[model samples]
Target: MNRRIRSIFWLMTICIIAINAFQGYWLWKTYQINRQQFASTVQSALFQSLEDQQVGDAKRLFIRKQKADSSSRMVIHRFDSMGSRHVRVFVNNRSDSISRIRIESEQPKRIVVTYDTQKRTTGANPLPADSIAKRISSLVLLDWTDRKRVNLAKLKAAYRSELIRRDIDATFQLDTLTSKPQNSLGNFVFYRNGDQLTTDDIIQTSPVPINPIQNLFVQATFAAPELYLLRQMGWLLGGSLLLLILTTGCFLFMLSTIMRQKKLSEVKSDFINNMTHELKTPIATVTAAVEALQNFGALNDPQRTQTYLAISQTNLQRLSDLVEKVLNLAVEEKRELVLHPEPVHLADVTNELITNHRLKATKPVIFDTSISQDAIVVVDRVHFGNALNNLIDNAIKYSRDKVTIQLSFRGNIDNWQLTVSDNGLGVPKAYQSAIFDRFFRVPTGNLHPVKGFGLGLAYVRQVVERHGGTITVQSEPGKGSEFTVHLIRRD
Candidate 1:
């Protein structure tokens, strides 16, 4: 089309592409950040839960180490040897004394037992040393095992609850595999099922191996973390999606506008070419006719001069009509089509156009008009007659030999229907819809037989619309075509 419009269109295209690309990039970055943040929050809560488990494990180990009864510690007064059946235990409570001592061991682990001198002198004879050692050792090991089970169950439950509170819903199995505790601050590191746990092997207790604490593992995993992040960013993601939709809509609208503008420019260009051809033909004919009258001394014979003069006048009138149609179209495009509505007879108007057509035809073409009644309509006489003439002229011009046209008036007094039918080479089904579009002519491939600048039906449709009427066509291929104009009859 035009250079300036083309430039603006290209600039808009680039802007749409660039903005979309930028938004895409921004969305990608936001996704990554959200994922990273979700991971960070999850890990932080996971490690904190692991630390809590470690503290619980430590507390269990301490409870196992102290075999004192709940009432008081089982302390030794003077016995302080690590030999068989003898051990020193601290008395943590001064006001009370231990009534019983519980010891637990699996196998091959030694157990030493001791008691206060006062309890030995209470008249209850002590059991045989070996039997006492074996029984207390087994009970201690049983108690420790039971407490271990309880503490482990609590730890697992706490771990799950902690994660849930942080919004991480994971399913896990307690890793049955076990290893000696690291005996250091790193004893609480968390591991998934398949992951590794690094440990340093320094001996923990200096005196004896009391509670052989080992690290237990709870391995967990959840579904997609990104999906979780998407849920978390509910309104944010929705707003972003809405923004994308709006952006896409704007892009499509701009593209559609540019394409329509380009199409209009092409149509206008064709109109200019066709207009130049139509105006030149009439002007050339008139010029030739006038030149002949001036140069050939045709005035010497009255009939010859009159014939040349008529030819000149006819061509000049045709030329003037073409120019006037163009000017009227321009004015209508600017929304300046003026109407001088007045009372007029529809039948008279139809008859006048038919009689004009008969007088203008070179070879005899059958033209007829039937007026049902002299119905009156309020319309601009000049433009309304011109609209009717255009429809009739197009019918004749596009027809084959033996051109027969009929004009008829129908309908009641309130509204009148004027139909013009012609036995022309009828319009194709494909081209009928677009016949009234400005500069849209039916394709006459290679022959160019039909003349006129494709403005006749368009002008007729516009003039009728300005007078508050409607026009339509009914036609079929190879059959005759009929144009019907409906206008309100004015009193």
Candidate 2:
């Protein structure tokens, strides 16, 4: 409500908002990076799949070409020391041999073939190395990009397996361009290596040429790359959100605490003002009566002396009651309230209190008693008696021209229930719970019509709770109010 508190509240609000905004922005950037990494991984898998498919095709093509040539024939010369066969091949029926070949079959699934082309002569009119390299590169590119020639089902299976090995699973559309790609663009392109037989001609009759091989592009469109990226960053996002929640919670708790402290400051000032006025009037009255007797020689007349003495006694008693209320509250707050339990007659105590209040009351008062006869309960006699008295006193002080009070005592199988009802200024529903808090008073404007510190109800609650009991209030603002005390019957 004050200017300084208001400013601090707004500043805290802005700070928390800024912190959350920064966290959100960081999370967004991380998501984008993950998306890029995911795309790269998919591209790598696709490139591997194309290479795998090409290698198998080249081997099949080489075997077919060797079978179609009639002039070149293979004859096993002899068995080598490594269990491989050394074979001589006469190409175009020339005695100056083109190459010597070796074939090794070690495993059922593997066959390695090698050629010795160093002894071949330029006299056989061999094709230039550049022409052979260029032709091989073109064939490889066409085989990779030609959609019909490519075995799509096998390629897809290989691609899926590669993705799984790298921990990626997503739906995608795989297509290839028949023309050579100019750039990578959005797709991944596969290029051949001329030095390695993986893409080059299998024949070693000429020196292999190093050339810039053209690439064939494979176009893959994923259904939801972002969703996959989000899955990857799930833990990071959750942690950020949790931290934001905790930060906001702490800010709210701090704000509420500040508000409560401010309200307590105002309440304490009001209590001091009320206490000063109350003490001042009683002290002034007792002082005046004592001074009159001593200075004016009022002792000469026995009646005058007695009257002045009674006035002094009455004001002094009021002062004693006021001071006791404050001291009781202070003692309870300093430490836990201590109680000495004893068995007492509840009905008798209630009757005695009603009698005392009726005798001392100046206004017209009516008492309605609905008490069970001889109801006994175990409790701290002194503190419990005072708690009852405070309730009765409050009922009387807040009443109209004429007062009507209803006091009841009852016993169940396990507990004793006592209620005090009065035709007084009842508490509002909102303040009913707060009335039992120390130093809290209903806002009655600047001038409080009633006198005394606001320690009565708080003390009553403390005493009741110390005895292992509970208290509750039910009231309407214009009508009357009822206070109930429930205490366990300790035998």
Candidate 3:
């Protein structure tokens, strides 16, 4: 059984470890995937943010040019009754050859013009116009070479907005850089900006061109990307951890229960063997004494007959006591052991038990007693006496040639204590805690020279607890053992 249990324990241990390892591998893969998705999302947002900034700048420039050119331009609009319109304009100013003209009315239209040095212009496809004229928007004179620093404040705002739009709530550091990074694309790259942002410190970095015409790009560096990822997968991580804890707890609980049951089975088997030996001795003795009286005609001699009868009665009594102890334990367990409590004098009981032990014990013994005569404690008299008797019986059975017993009963303000100490073969420290457990003996194996079914201490504990009391043992191997029973004082 022990070997089987050990095998099961090792197997379960390996299973638990494998489960943890697999879970750890799975989580790592998941983290990597989430990281990749995050980087991709950030890159997309950066590109979209650049486009948004460019559109805004271009619209502002166009609006400013239109307002400036509106005063010097010729306005033409032809509308039918159905609000359908065609616009045609000829600019009289011969500033530059017609380059680009954007016309905006109820609907936006672009009419690009081609011209000659004669200060005359014609549309690519004209609408019945005889002569040609030049029309140029104010944008034609502006220099494209003056590339100012990209609007960092505006870019940051747009970048953050785009990230939020994509469901990412992470903080970042943004800067415009003209020099391209020399590092490979997928690996972590360092961007040092006084804060010393290293590759390890950075979560992700996305570089996007500031504008279409410039070589400059905006770089966004995110710190602690893992924190964000953890928050995103909070529920999944939490649930997995909880399940792992519960699984380990259940495994430990099951293992402990198995071990406890195994111990119980061994103890019960020992109890059964001990009970059989105990029963056989008394039965054999009685049978022999009866046989002597019936077959050997011991009845013819009154003295011999009386001796046989006495021997038979004594053995019968031993058998009856053995059966009674077993039955009482069973009845107590089945019915939850109710106690009928009454006031009992502690001193009188102890004195009577001491006298009985002195008269009945076969070995040479010494009794030392300290009992409070005035101490009257509430307890079930019969059960309490039986409990004490079991303790005395055990002390004598377990001792060497000469046994010295100490019986002490004292009453405190809160409780009454009865202590039984003896110079017996004291129990080892390791087995003290288990001594009160049913069918648990200090010595292991099938047969023990000491009598009793290992029910004495168990019955004592049950009786004491049922009376709202407690029992404790203090023992040192070879020195001796002291058993104390504490009963609560009731007014």
Please, what is the TM-score per model?
0.57, 0.70, 0.77
Of 1 and 2, the candidate ahead on lDDT is 2
The TM-score of candidate 1 is 0.57
Q: Residue by residue across 1-491, what tens digits does model 2's lDDT show? A: 59999999999999999999999899988887777677777776665665545544543443355466444543323333233323333333444332323323222122233434465443342233333233333444444345333355777788889888999887766644333344768433343232221223211111111111222234456766767677777788789889999999999999999999998888788889888989999899988988988899999989999999899898899999888878866776789878998878877888889899989887888989887766778888888999999999899988888889999888863588899999888999999988998778888888778886778898899899888899999998878799999988555
Residue-wise C-alpha lDDT for candidate 1, range 1-491, written one tens digit per residue? 47877788788778878887888788789888876665565555544554454333433443455454344333333221122122323344343233323232222144544444444443333333444455546654554455443344665577578768977664443333334445686443333344544333111111122233333333333445556666777777788778878987987887788878887777776677677778788788888877878888877879988898898888889888988878876787888678898878887887787788889775558877777555777789999999888988888887777788888887765687888998888888888888998888876643456667787788888899987788999998777899999987544
Per-model tally of clashing residue pairs: 3, 0, 0
Per-residue C-alpha lDDT of model 3 across residues 1-491, encoded as one tens digit per residue: 88999999999999988987888788889989999999888887776676555534434554455457554443232211122212233443434333223332122122234343443334332222222222222232131235666678988898899999999999888876554345677333333343434455465565554532344556787878889999998998998788889889989999999999998888888878888999999999999998998999898999999998899899999999989878877887788766788778877887888889889888988888887677787778898888988998889988999999999877763577889999888999999999999888878454466777778898889888888789999999898899998877555
> Which residue runs of candidate 3 sit more than 4 Å off their true CA positions?
69-153, 175-191, 194-197, 211-217, 294-297, 409-413, 444-447, 486-491
Number of the top TM-score candidate: 3
Which candidate do you rate higher for lDDT, 1 or 3?
A: 3
Q: Score residue 428 of candidate 3 by CA lDDT.
A: 96
- Candidate 2 global TM-score: 0.70
lDDT of 3: 0.72
- Per-candidate Cα lDDT values, in order, are 0.64, 0.69, 0.72
In candidate 2, the residue pairs with backbone N, CA or C atoms under 3 Å apart (3 or more residues apart, or in different chains) clash, namely none
Worst 10 residues of 3 by lDDT: 77-86
What TM-score should be assigned to candidate 3? Answer: 0.77
